[model samples]
Target: MSALTDNTYRLLRAQVTGATDRIVKLALFETVSEVCRLSLSIDPPTDPLSDFAGWLDDDQWLKNHTLVIAGTLARLYAMPKRPWSDIDTARVNKEQYDTLLSYARADAAEAPNIDPTARLLGSIRSRLPGAKDSQTRLALFDVLQEACQRGRIWTELVPFRLVPGKQVFSIAQPGARIVMLLNAQHSVLGMQALNYSDEKIAVRTDIATLNPADLLYLTMALAPSLGADMENPATWMPGDIFASKYTLLLHGVLGAMMLQTAKPYSNTALGQYHTQIYSRELNAAPLTDRDGGLPTRQRWRFPRFA
Candidate 1:
């Protein structure tokens, strides 16, 4: 048998036999079939075991296909999904945060090709209220990076849920839908400026003359990795109960946004800040809970083909 076929056989055998759970075995089997269909550009067998046997019959085919198979599997593993747990979300967030730090420290002039703001804008343009100038975009990116370094970040998006309520209608009429706001106070921008009277004017601090809330909204639109630092929660908002949770949720949403903008298996180099952030695993400490203490440095690993 060729090396490709041999490797495939080994992987399947190991997975099928090693897994005690039937669910895991079936998932692996389905994944293998999908990868084969993608890499070989052929219709896979209805039976996964039969498909494995067929590959073994063609040594030449296997020899020519090993690399593609390995690469495709690696790419799948690397592709981000809604994280399975808060711990997983925290881990990925830390990785992305470290990448932002590196970009912040790098001399922008040295890397003429890199444009962090453009990449961030590309990911979040759909959410922005209006278009921003190049200078505004760059400034926003800088402020967010600084926020990550200082750990003054708040990460979560505002949460809303839909509910069906009784509506005045004829028989068999459907209920009117209403939105129940949850975590409405989870504002990254903090609070709105109030106009109390004509005689008294309250001037709020502005970034580039943009409203503080607007600037905060724009910063969040880019999905920065750092979330509220529990140790110094005063910056996010003193006595906010859900501050940490909001920060975690923000990182999770940013990760999801990045995945939305990602083009899998692309040949082009990741030159933008947003894209480059996911390009490699960074050596950074995983974020811990408030009582859990400071983060410890650890090495993260991704699949080779990714």
Candidate 2:
């Protein structure tokens, strides 16, 4: 099984056993909902393979089936909604890193052709004159790989937006919310870095210590805590309170799975989680009426100088 599969299974098992904290529980439930949606997409009427009950009770079944589940989660996690263009850039960064690494490891005659005009590669070439040395080249290759990994995580964590009148909810909404939960986990660990761009909100974190599976679980568990804050009628009214309650219950299970900490769950902690989540979710302008026609006015375009 892949490392992600193994880790995801373990974290899921922990969640099942009530071993995580409250914030994590919230996120886990949300992640599970996403997994269910993916499963439905695979086979809507009778997805026997995606049945949670079949794998939940039996440890062996859970282990055997996790690869598909984990892979789906990872793919969903990596996908970007409309209006978010950075995901493609991250993918390109990964491809470039892989290409550079292969070249660095290969003999000079075996090196692959790389476009000098590529933005990332151009920046590296300009800064490191001696990058031709095998060791230096290899080091540079590693740096790109690391940077790409970070970029991948960043793109995955941020949700894409659509122009007003395009869609009520961004296609990437669920994944973005899930990423918020993960960021909440990072905030607790003192590792989250969130920033806003003109197009979309972006997030970064020190996730080197987190396993893919652990990260997934953390994200899953954090969603509920965030929803609870968002559901407040004074701040943001919930469309369906019953559904929200059900979600909160699922998150409660996730919270139970967390390692016990000295600080108790209090209003302060709740506020902290809420603040972290809203910081990202509320950064963008409010969604305009979906039924409205697209505006005819053309926005100004800036020219780039070569």
Candidate 3:
């Protein structure tokens, strides 16, 4: 049994229209995951086996166990392959999940940072040789923003529950986290077709056919939070999205910096060369869409220049 499987509702498994023990456990796991992934602001947690603390112990988790149950049922009955498919009942469960998830999203900030992703990473700021003036400091922020906007240097996973019949979904986090939706995936279900604009995710499926707690995992190309003070390098951390992909972020920043027209670091030829390297490494990642066609994420690698 996984850490989440508890005797709390063992009897529920044997009742009318009962579910297997495995389905219950998976539902619990996904419920916990939805909250846990918010802090990441980057890639979704890669390993499922890793321990997630506060299991069954947290008050909110216990109180909202229905969110877990409701979400699961919505998935269960909505399946076309299942003999128990019940569209009407599924819609009711989905409505409950949607209302609950809205509350969940509202309180997302209070969710524990299992990996502490919101913490500052000084790696990028550390690259700039102690610039004395505010201008140089802000330049660092500007260039990073530009590089991120120019292409998908790295990707972030953001999961949100689907609201049935909602026409357009916004992934915009303006002034907070700069991100573009490179691709999207549906939990339980697979990759969803994404025709996005202004971070509005438009998928191919009919909304009524989907249920709430039906998670849509948006693979976003992210820029770290820009709300930090430009004058204070200590405050300039790049969020967890860049945690494992520091090289890609650095290359993008450096390339953009060198290409700046009037900056002290401007070196057109060198900038173009570094930019080329940035592009190469960006494409190498197995899951990132650096070129806007098909994103990969083989880990954007960087080579030291001679």
Candidate 4:
């Protein structure tokens, strides 16, 4: 049952009928995987799913994740020069297929606030060589981490109190991760790390400096939300930073994918298509929510009561 049945091929073909042509099962099979990989690269799943061949035979995957199959059909039927190609009908299928992807992406927004790493990984794999290679995941992780760092603007109000007459005070969280202290007006506080090792810092209060009287809270340029291991698919995505902005990861990879010399996924268009989307999403995103998008302090201050 792990192979596409003749009935399945016929079912897929029914959507793109042609007098002079039919999609061979083998060809369709390959197309199914290509579409699946590309689709996943666009929006990664939090939990790992079956590979393309197994999913083709999986009743649940076919029934629930129909976009993968629909996308394949749309490509073959609409991509031009095929005997069975029909741009008009293919447009309809492609529209429906894209709509499904959109819906799934929207629904994913409601799921647990996980990292976009797993999703980004799938995306990187789809566009480049070494789809599941470890080195590739790490390299792409660096790409994702860089994006996260640049976009690392989130706040948390943890256990911190100004000790009067003291130049230094211990932070509720580590000093190395803290970006800066913020005043109540959300202005960066002129504070310096006295000792990152001790997680202590000093704040300057003067005519030219912001006041700690209404000291806002902690800001972090922390590492992505994920477990220690990069190899684990389960731990691939970090927390909220990516859940909603998962598409940003897609955009990032697409822009980067253009630079790749890899076939099939490569494009001569370079980063034009990808860059706009990446910047738009990254710039358009409001600073991550104070609580949800940032899980670092909570993990540190409130270790599992579980």
Candidate 5:
């Protein structure tokens, strides 16, 4: 490796390893918070599907995906880990497993390899948003059911597609370099679009200006390894969770890169001041207001693949 590249890799390894303790702690807190948020709404019997349906609108697709993601995350982070959980051992399709495994291998080495799983994931993700795909629909339902039992969130490996046209251009398979799109609000820029054509795999953004809530939300959404209470650790294992962790790290780096691209801000100051201000603003702001900020609370819209 070139001296520059080698130096950079060393730096990243140091950073990730150094923060492993923090990541584990932060992930635990996040998992608990999501559960608490859900608990506040759930009634006796705790029918998560019903609770989910009531909490969300008619957008079943997005609801299914989000619930599945949340559920899977919860399961992964569940305390006192359940080792024999079927959710963790349920056989993944051979082809799909192979594809993701290959991607994972590539990711470890930081190699650029084509990932078939990306195509499948993109297709499902696209369809899940609104397309009437029975498999996608059923899979999400199954995932939700799994979540109810084990608190696991199911995820698929997919390719980063071009926006507008939503065409699959390149896949950030395992080990492939990735870029982050969203700021703290999960407002993703068209990084996939830009990466499709160039060697670059990130976007330009004002991370220094990002609201802290947005960062927290982004952290929740981006960190794949982080989970809520869903199953026992022995059942799923740390290796199983690392993939998600890597993905989240990539997203975090993307956010950091965006800030770097903008006017340089000391990392220390960005974490302290900007994050605090953003957090206060987010906490103070209303999620929604009906009648154009009138007294009535506006209904919350669950975002689908849109």
Candidate 6:
């Protein structure tokens, strides 16, 4: 079995115990939700991921999945909402990052191709002499700025996930590691990895120190404790028209909160998971107008430069 399959198998096995499974799943959900909240806070309109570079070294950051998840959450929050059709066409809009764009354009002016993109890249290369080409320089600069912005958003989101997870078993990795552990066990569940990295994984599970199977069980047991609305399954529950709407809304509120709190998968991972979820439930991936189109507008589109 692939490592992923082994992980999934373990998660299902962990779940078979009933109470433990639900508890872990819910706790996992809560940790993910709180991380998303801290990273993508509605208040003050900020993302903490951008600031990570200031406080963390590359090796430290890479091993810190909790912060990574928080960073992902911040990036998701920092994302601008735009029409799906226009996402790729919407570069930095050449307006907000005009200073950088113009600098790039002027640099490439002397190139043989004189590609505007080339010019902009050339401009960057002059300043960053070691850059091999325009694409390299541009990518480095953009990604750096983007990372910085994401770090800042994560700073706010981390506290929520940290406190709650600590209340349980010190959730260090953003929930993605838990997700990774779960999916790894259920390889046949048609699960696809979203966005995960070693640094991101390290924060949640000290893979070096913990047993995979044991950790899976512990994760499952802790899931419930992390939930904002966790309760023992009550004897009687109300059934009403409003209840249905409320349930849907509840999922939305929680899911949105998760997106804001959880780390976002990369575009490729996002697409793969979207396809996986679509295949399973077509309508369950939070893509409705009533969700206020938040899901649709979170990713960046191409055609980034003029």
Q: By lDDT, who's the top model here?
A: 3
TM-score for each prediction? Answer: 0.20, 0.17, 0.38, 0.43, 0.17, 0.16
**Model 3 lDDT on a 0 to 1 scale:** 0.52
The local lDDT score (0 to 100) that residue 248 gets in candidate 1 is: 26
Q: Positional deviation of 234 in candidate 5, in angstroms?
A: 50
Give the winner by TM-score.
4
Error of 5 at 25 (Å): 25
- In terms of lDDT, the poorest run of 10 residues in model 3 is 297-306
- Model 4, 71-107: lDDT tens digits are 6667777766767878887776677567556644443
- Cα lDDT tens digits, model 2, 155-194, are 2223232232322222234322222222223322332343
Per-residue lDDT tens digits of candidate 3, residues 1-306? 122234224422532165665654565466556644542232333444444334444444333444565666666667565556688877877776675565445434443553322222233233334433454446556645655655544455667777778757877754445454455566544443445555466666776687776787666666647676665544443444444444454456656667778765667875775566457445444333333344352222112210
Residue 164 of model 3 has an lDDT of: 71
Clashes of each: 2, 24, 14, 7, 29, 57
Using lDDT as the measure, name the better of candidate 1 and candidate 4: 4
Candidates 3 and 5, the one with greater lDDT: 3
What's the C-alpha lDDT at position 45 in model 3? Answer: 38
Worst 10 residues of 5 by lDDT: 215-224
Distance from true location, Cα of 170 in model 2, Å: 35
Q: Which ten residues in a row have the lowest lDDT in candidate 2?
A: 283-292
| Candidate 6 ranges beyond 4 A from true positions | 1-22, 42-272, 285-306
- RMSD to the native, candidate 2? 26.4
After superposition, the stretches of candidate 1 with alpha carbons farther than 4 Å from their true spots are 2-7, 11-32, 49-51, 55-306
Query: What lDDT does each candidate get?
Result: 0.31, 0.29, 0.52, 0.49, 0.29, 0.27
Candidate 1, residue 181: Cα displacement in angstroms equals 79
Error of 3 at 111 (Å): 29
Two-way TM-score contest, 2 vs 6, winner: 2
